[model samples]
Target: MTRKPSGQRGPVDHERRDQIIAAAHEHFRLYGYKKTTVADLAKAIGLSTAYLYKFFESKKAIGEAICSLCHDTLLSDIQAIVKDNITPSEKLRKIFQSLAHNGAELFLHDRKMHDIVASAIEEKWHAAIAFDQELSSIIRNLLLEGRERGEFERKTPIDETCRAIVLSLQPIRHPALLEYNLETLDNDATMIANLVLRSLAP
Candidate 1:
């Protein structure tokens, strides 16, 4: 996650930064990310463009913040899934399904916000990287639990297995790649999760 900017205006004031993000989110949602400008955002919120820079370095930075917020919320939901009273196998299935559905919702319904995420993925922004890392960690823990419970094989190293599972889900997980598999993402997510579970069989 990018550090929330702080300047000579005393301690960090997230109220202003959050205000900027709230406005940007609405603006981006309305006008799309690429077509919107920082100055336009400043105008929308009644702040000067220079003052807007105090919280975010550039337009991309603001985009990153918005993108990160989305990722964080999704991650929290997924984390709750992990904590649910479900088997590791079932958790894995749910995780993949949720990811596929979320991607489809973004691309098919929220095109404007999807544009921000697409750019974040294309540019390998911090938000995307951080989301992937944290997700991989969650998957790793799930795999370890499965192995300990004899629900999954332990022959393969967890890291390699985790990477393979992540890669297998990437077609649906990635924004840029979502369109190609849009028609079959729901079925594909379940099928892929099942396939991974089979491979992990003890």
Candidate 2:
């Protein structure tokens, strides 16, 4: 039997890398980042730890990849909501609520995974920064649309107003703020959104 050339391993290598990432994601979600070691991930995929290292240099590397995937999924959701055929005001409200809801679910469903996110943010990970920038951009675009539609009045520059909006809702969107009870978090989000809307009213 003829063996495949080394250059022909691209597709197979990509597939294996993805498999390793998926396995690591599940392990981290279930067992927390600190508890889920490279050995565990390799065992899950029926590979040796040395082989896993060929795909990801370290466990932190795998964790970063997983965080990137999650952030991409979130950005896609926000992008879709922004482009939906809804009033700018309604879209803004939904975007705020969706972000709060997603953060809360992540905190409550898997504290381990949430901890990974917290560390990523604290470490200033590239994926975390990109995620934050994308979210800000979405909000800024929505505010611009609102201004064009005369649904909102901007007392300050659009960029400043966008920053204010994000800061005002940080309690709901920030992982550190997820320590509050669910009811309190929900109420705070509602009140904050209302205040932002009122501030932006024409």
* lDDT per residue as tens, model 2, 108-140: 887777788787788887667778888888889
lDDT of each: 0.87, 0.78
RMSD of 2: 5.9
Per-residue lDDT of 1-202 in model 1, one digit per residue for the tens?
Answer: 4354212232355688787889999999999999989899999989999998777778988898889888987898799899999999999999999999998998888888888999988988888888888999999999999999999999898899999999998888888887888999999999999999999999
For all predicted structures, in order, the TM-scores are 0.93, 0.85
lDDT of 1: 0.87
Q: In lDDT terms, which candidate is top? A: 1
